[model samples]
Every structure is written in C-alpha cells, then in structure tokens.
Target: MSSPEQWTRPEPGAGPAATAAQPSPEQVIAGLRATAEGGAELTQLLTPEGERQPSRFDPYLADIDDAALRGLYRDMVLVRRADRECNAMQRQGQLGIWVPLLGQEAAQVGSGRALKPQDMAFPSYREHGVAYTRGVDFRELLGIFRCTDHSAWDFREHGFHPYTIVIGNQVLNATGYAMGQKFEGKVGNTDPDGKPSGTDEATIVYFGDGATSQGDVHEGFVWAAVYDAPVVFFCQNNQWAISEPTERQSRLPLYQRARGYGFPGIRVDGNDVLACLAVTRWALDECRHGNGPVLIEAFTYRMDAHTTTDDPTRYRLSDEIEVWKHKDPIERVRVHLARTGGADQEFFDQVQADADAFAAELRDYCFNMPDPPPERIFSEVYAEPSAALDAQREEYLAYLSGFADGGEQ
Candidate 1:
C-alpha cells in the first residue's frame, strides 16, 4: 500500500539538492503514481435490454421480483421528475438555486436502494434523490437551497449525514465514522449462532469529479486503507466538474485510483442502473466483511447544467448532451422491463401516473413550504445560547417589534 510517507519522498537520481522541500518535477512524478495496478469487476445485472446477470450479492437483490423492478423504475422516474421540476422551479424563481441530477437517476437510485436500514450515508449536495430514498422529506432538501434553513433533517435520525457543500469533505467524515464503528466493535464480529452478524454497518459517501482534485479525498483514501474502514467512496464521475472535463482531473481512469489506496476500485456505467447497483452492492459487502474501503467511479455523462445557475451550453456542445440523452437511464430500464416482459402497459401507465402525481405534490409543497420562525435560524447554531447571542436576540427582537407595531400582542 502507498503510504503518505512514500508519496512525500523524492525519486532516485534527483540529486542530494532535491530534498523533501524541493524535489525535481521528475522525482515528484516518479514518487506519486497512479493506483490502477489491479483492475476491478464492473457488473451489469440488468442490461439495457432488461436482462439479468448472475449477481454475487444475490442475497442483497434476490427478492427483486418483476413488481419490485417496476418499483425501482418508479423510483428513477419520480426522482428525475422531482429533480427536473426543482430545476424548473429555480428557473422560475421558486428556489434560490437548484442542482439537477437530470441524467444520473439510475446511479443514485441503484446505490441508494442497496443501503440497508443500519447502513449510513454521507452525501454531497447533489444527493437529494438518495436522501429521498432514505425517507428524508423532499421539501426539507429545498430548505437549504431556498435559504430557509441550514439543513433539513437531523443526521442521526436519518442515518445520513448533512449534505456537505465542500467538494470532498464528507469522504473523510464517512471514513472516520466507519472507523469509529469498527473501534466501537460494531463491525466484523459473527453472531452468537455463528451466523453473520447484521450489527456491523457500512457507510457510503457520494462525491463528484471535481472532488478528486481535493486533498481531503486523497487523505480519506489514506485513512480508509490504513484502518480498513467500512466505507464506500462513491465517485460519480459525471465527465465534467463545472467547466473542466475529466481529462483535466487525471490522466488514467478514476476507478483505478483505488489500487494505490490498497482497496478495490470498480468503474461502472453510471447511466446503467443495474450496473451501478451491482457494483455498489459488491463494494458494500466487502466493507461489511471488514475487507474495505472500496472506490467506485460511476462513469456517466452530465446532460444538464452543473447547477441551475450554470449554462452548460457556454462550454459544452449540444451534440454531447444529445449523445448522452440516447443513453438515458430511464429509457434503458424501460427497455429492460419491456424486453423481459417484467412490465406490461398497465405497469408503465401506473408508474407514469405515480411519477406525475408525486411531482405535482412536490411542486405544491415547495411553494407552500413555510418560512421558518425567526428564532429557528439561531436555534441550532449553539446548543446553549451564549450571553452575547441572548442579548443580541433580545435587542433584535425589540428593534423588529418597533416596526411591527407589536404584532404578537
């Protein structure tokens, strides 16, 4: 395994002058190498045509009948509609801003569904869909973007952490949490009956392509490898990080980076829901067995703007978006369902209706979401209010009351 000490050393033949402080560029290059020495498996359970491949993690997905597959399809559709609708809401001035997961529904849903009740998740801001799957209120996510609240749900309550706005900060946090779980003896031990103990829980953290450039992410890799953290560092390599393409992030494939960290790293077709689910489940299982942390780079295309505020048309071509549209995640699942006779016309119709109804309800909720009480703003800022804050709050309230004509009375 490549340690931090190894990464900091100067290469041979770089001369004595090339000390740790001032190593030659060639020495630095030789010292820091790519991690893809050993490749990984990228399985696709349900092909675009909706066929099944044997899954080693069959226990995780064994009960997924035709109706269940249709439910998964419904999940993708509703989430996408919710995503696109939120973007449109932002455009129409309902939300302050929006992050569109337009083309990555399968990536989010597949992995999100793989999570058990005990498993924890750490997410970037774009993981609203995954949050939705975890029983987080859809409107709660809007509170952050709408500038109504800092975070919507309590982390402990949801078994999910607050959305980290900093690119890769959650990567390390997830690793640390998993490590803590291990230290607490919550992982790797068998049950009294000699059966596998379900008490041990794994963690999954989501990140984007740009996060690969952050030092925190690399440090996360280091810590996870050393301690064998039960964490899955899921990198949704959506091809572009803002205006910068994947080419600028690293020379080799992103999934291969896991080798240097002494763990398995697999690359899946992010646009393929089955592929994403199969790969993520396998990685999580390895973690549950105390054999991880794993890295997953879901290779996908970002078919929408980086955010509602961004204009992808400024930097990317129309043809590129069109190309990915043909590889639409929802379409492939529908194809698979149709091909395998898993879903008939009635099923498709019900799914469409469900998606539309959910979208409409979400739109209503977003518009009707009450603005939080003024005091709620500072409620969680401090567990116990300091003297200064108390005095300030009183003064502010008094000042506001003067303008309000004592409306409370």
Candidate 2:
C-alpha cells in the first residue's frame, strides 16, 4: 500500500540552495533526480517529452487522426486563454471571484470530449475546459461568477450542469441521475457498431481530491456500485484540497477507495491528454455495457492557487510547484503536435491569434454585462411566495423608488 506521503512527498533533492529566504520554483524542481519507480495500474499513452508508447488504449485512439488531434490542442489553448482572462478580470474587480484550472486542462478536456451529447456532466466550479468542449459560449460562463445570472445557459441544452460550489455534493446528484437512466434502460449501447442504439444516457460527475473525504461522495459511490449506475466518477486528484495534502485526506491512493466500493478503478496520467481520453472512453463503454460505475482517478496536479482568493505560496513550497510544471498537460500535446507534423507553424500561429481574439472578446463581454436587476434578488425565493422575502423585496424596492426621478415620487 503506497502511503499518502509517498503520493505527495516532494521529489528527491530539494536542491542545496533552496531556502525560505529566496524561493525558486524552477530550481527546486530541476534538482530532483527521481524516475518512475513503481505504481499501481496507471495508464500512460503520451510521455512528458511528447513520445507515444504502446498501450492497451491504442485502439481507442484509432479515430483520433492528426486533424482531430489538432482540434484537441485548439480546445486546450482556447480554454486556457479564457481561464487566464477570467482570472485577470477577477483581479481587476470585474468578477466576484474565479476558480482557476491552470494545470488540469487535459483531464477536463479529454474526458469532456469523450462524452456523448446525450450524456450528462456534473461539475465542480473549475471545469472551464469541459465547458469549452461542450460548445458553451465563454460569456455564459462569466455570467455566473459575475453574479449576473444563475447559469450561463440551460443545463440540459449542453448536458453540462451548472457549477456546484458546495464541494462534493453533486456526486450524489449525478449518481441518482445515472440510476434513473439505468432503471429506464438508458445505459450505453452494446452494439458492435459504435452508433447510438438508444436514447438512454450515462452521467459523469467531476470533483476534486478534497471531496473524496465528504460523506456524500462516498455515499454516491455506494449507491452507484449497488445499483450499477452508468456513471463515471472522475476525480482529478491534484494533490491538495485547499491547504491539506492527499496525505492528510486518505490513507492510500484515492482510486483504491473504489475497490472497497466494489468496482474497478484506474489511475491515468492526467497530464497526458491521450491517456485521459482513452481511460474515460473505456470507462464510459463499460457503463453502456451495464458493467459500470467506473471510477477514474486522474493523477494530476493543480499548478495554481485553488482559487483567485488563495495564496498558494503560504501552503505549498515554490519547489513543489516547479516539479509539476514539467508534466504540464498543454505543453506535452503541443510538443507531440510539432514533432509528429500533426500541426505546423501556420497552425500554431493561427491558434495563438484565435486565443488572443477570444480573450479580447471575453474581456469586453465581462465588462459590458450588466449586473442583475435588484428584482432578481427577490425572485425565486420559493415555489409560491414567502411573506418574509416578499416583504423584504417590497421594502427594498420602495427604498429604490424613493431615490428615483430626483425623489419626486
């Protein structure tokens, strides 16, 4: 059993010069001399250096041609650009707050792309990459954090749920949805031909390393396992749940927890987009075959603060941040694309230009989007109307009306 400390302990040699006074994230990571020593069943199709290896998942990539590969790259690039702009907006006081998914792009994008349009996804707040794959407009995402709307778009329209800010609770909701689909015979198709045979659906829920400790997450696991729900529990274990490390969260690797829940769990190199897509595809296939609910622990890292409000330097060492940068999800794919001739200078240039234009558009949208009307605060308090809320809304409105028209009325 690999301990939590083993899972998170900094790579060897923190470098002699590393000190509390002058911190260097780069030097701390470059000094490490460790290699891939041992692990439980972890799948890796793309190496950090952008090399491909033979794996059981090779067949899954048959349809992922060079053009498709370029598309995925484009997804990562644009999503990252949007995320960066949102973070900047928050810093500029345009947004209330922002959840930055700096290093977890591949894990979100790969799995999101694997999902069918009919399938549903439940997300924690930081799923910008998934939103991009779902064809969600960037402005819609801004509406949420800016407090202008409940959601950017209809959830069912994109099959992507509104972001759940309350941590792991969405796991149970996703499981219940999956179970309902199961009872309705909506499990994925088992046909030899890969077309949809029925309109039934599968569900996927995204949470983080911290949420695994929540009772709701565990209960969702239990119910899904017992009922054979066609759901994929995707946990991007990015090594920290706020300031607490995985070592403090569990005794062993998080994926191992699925074994106790009586289903198979697989760990994948979350930084490798190909591996993430392959593993998620395999799990979703199992769900369609009624052999579900599969748990996928995307072994990855969060290369930034948990949110814009967080000061990562206070909790984690600079060296620790540097170490994970080597395994960056976007860079690996870019390297592969360049080396394999999957994309050329023109393609790369176009992507950068597109990202810039997209970011500019997002900046304008966020700045121009109006604040929710005051009436919005009072609406939707209850199914009918609540006396207390109604009275409060009326009083607030009266106060506003008095100030209007130079206090004439």
Candidate 3:
C-alpha cells in the first residue's frame, strides 16, 4: 500500500488518454499468476489435491495422529452437513434466517479443535462449525435461527459467548476476557520462565475480513497488544464482506495490519485444515506462554451467499465460485484419508451414514419445533421477573388473544 502523497491519479478530464495503456493479455495473465503466488506464501501443510506439504510449522502438526486427522475430517463433514440443513430450513421457512458457513468448514473445525477447555471463544454469528467442534449439538444451533432463544446454548458453560450479531464487538469482549485472565494471573502462572506451557488458558475470537475495518476490532488489537493479553484474533478472510469484496476494506493483506498494533501476524491457507490447525495451535501456545495477542488471517473463500436471504449471484461471478471448488477443504481431507490409508472405505461409509442420520434428525426437529409461547420471551430476559415485565407480558398476551383464531387483528 502507498500513501496518497506517493501515488497519484490521472486528471479527470484526460478520459481515454489517461488510460495507462491497457495491459496486454499476456501481462494480465502474468499479474494474476503473481497474485496467486503472493497468497500461496502463507504456511500451507496440505494441498487442495490431498497431498501433504512440509513447512517450518511442521512441528505443530506432531500430535495430529491418523485418528486425530480422521476426527478433523469428521468434524468438517458433520459441520458442513449441519450448515446445509440450516440453509435448507431457512429456505423452506422453518427458520427465520440462517448464516451458512458453507466453504469454511476446515478453517473453523481446525482452529476450534486447537483450544483447551479452559480457554474462551467469542464468535461472530456464523461460527456453527466452531460450536460443533466445541461439542455443542448441531440441533442447538437451529433454535436461535428458529427464533425461540437468544442463542442455542449457554455461553458461560461452554466458555463461548452468545453469537454477537453486532459486527466486531466480540473482539473487544475476547480481549477484555484475556486481560482479565492476565490480571488474575491466569496467564504465565504455569510458565514463570516464559517458556511454552499448556497450563495457561487463552482466548480465541473469530471475526471476518470486514471486521478488520471496524473500530472495535482495532481497539481490541490495541488493548491486547498493550496489555499482552492472551488472546488470538482469528480473522477468516473469506474474500468478501457481504457484497463488498475484501479489496475495498484494506489496501494490504489483512494479516499485515497486525504490524501496526505491534504484534506478529500470520496468514495460513484457510482451506487447508492441517495448516489452520498448526497455525492456531502455535498462536494459542504463544498466548499461554504470555507472548500472546496474535492475529491469524485465514485466507479462504465463502462459497455461499452471506446469508440465506442474500442473492450471491447479484454480486459475484459464477466463475469465481467454480475456481474455489477445486480448493474444497473437506474434499482434500477425504481424499488424503483414503489415498494415504488413514481411513478405509468402511470408515468413510460410517462417517457419511452418521452425517446423513444427524441431518435427518435435525430436519425432523426443525419441522416439528412448535412456536414458542409469547410469554416465554419475557421470562428469560431477567433472572428475577419484575412487576413491569410481568405486566407487559400479560398485556402482550391479552393483545394477542384479541385476534380471532386464524383471523387478522
């Protein structure tokens, strides 16, 4: 990126003469190739074709045994299935709205598995995949979209906050939590010498490329850096912030922005599950040892619309989606598991069967879910019901009863 003073635009009246001679076809193709190469500079442990690639970060992948690798595959498969079901339900009118994590399964599952139980997670609304890896039932996710609960599960019990619909706000929450951990000596207690220690808990917060432009996220970065908070800012740069492409948000790669905050930033191939796992594990380890507040930009693409209500075709090209298909995260893992003898045909079949059964059960649950009583909403808002709230609920119920059954008010 260049400062405005260092770069200049042509005079507005120059018209066609201002065109800096359109690039030759060969030059255009070369520039595209270069762009891809720059992106490929990130740490990638696995290729889209299911081949294992070596990197300096290889040590982080040590404990990821064949069984663990298979488990990761299972996580992505099931998460993807659940997401697809949610999208379908929304389209079928069983859900009011749905945020599908269509193509980012590997990124979510890989990083979600890296956290220890004591650590915390503050998620953006679409982290259903992370919730899955955290052991939250897929069925639980539907309730929120079904408009019955604020969220599907309890935030405190799971060490995961309720989904923050306000973009980038969760970053501050995660940062504050990490700061609290430091204030209470939760961090660096086990590693007095500052060496790596797994005993110290960390916080991992998820956001998207768009959030990078938000003040809350930047504020979180500043707070985390200054306080040395044991927080990892995981940004899934899925190439778009709704209809706005990433270029509009940042002049440079999102990861590089961490430099301004005085911490290390890393870019990992988000579509590569093994790579995401390794990078996230390293980030959490750094925080545990009190060298925290890392920013990891997971470079990937969202293969679906921003939400069920979004018409992606209006904003993006079909060719772009097709290109990302070759880089499907789940497909690579499945291919690796089979080709490398990590998993057999029987195992693959079992995984598919389980995923299908789970999706079917979820569909049944969504279809049969009864409308929540109107009074139920006010009950959960406060721990001890107040007279005003109770009276308000009663008044609302009375108004609702004014309408005849199946008749307009």
Using TM-score as the measure, what is the rank order of every candidate, best first? Answer: 3, 2, 1
Better model by lDDT, 1 or 2?
2
Better of 1 and 3 by lDDT: 3
Candidate 3, residues 256-372, lDDT tens digits: the string is 999999999999999999999999999998898889699999988899999888998996667667878998999999999888999999998899898988899999998997777
Clashing pairs for model 1 are 49-336, 50-336
Error of 1 at 113 (Å): 0.7
TM-scores of all models? 0.86, 0.87, 0.89
Give the clash total for candidate 1.
2
Q: lDDT per model, in order?
A: 0.78, 0.83, 0.83
TM-score quality measure for candidate 1: 0.86
Quote the positional error of residue 137 for candidate 2 in Å: 1.2
Give the alpha carbon lDDT tens digit for every residue of 1-409 in model 2. Answer: 2222333343465422332223244432332221121154778888889998889988888999999889988988988998999999999999989999998999999999988888899999999898878878878999888877767578899999988999899999999999998998887554567775655578889999999999999999999999999999999988879977665556566888999999998889888899999889888878877887999999888888999899988877776677788888889989998999889999999999999999999999889887766878778558787989989988888888878572332
Clashing pairs in 2: 186-200, 188-288
Per-residue lDDT for 1-409 in model 1, tens only? Answer: 3322233342364353223344444433332222211124555566545556676656667667878778778989989888888988898888999988988888898889888788999999898778987888887888888888877687787887888888899998998999997788766778889876887789999999889999999999999999999999999888778986554456467888988878988888787777777678778878887886999888777778898889888865565666677778899889888888888989889888888888888889988988776666556778876888888778877766787665242
Query: In model 2, where is the ten-residue run with the lowest total lDDT?
Result: 29-38
Off by over 4 Å in 2: 1-40, 188-198, 380-392, 402-409
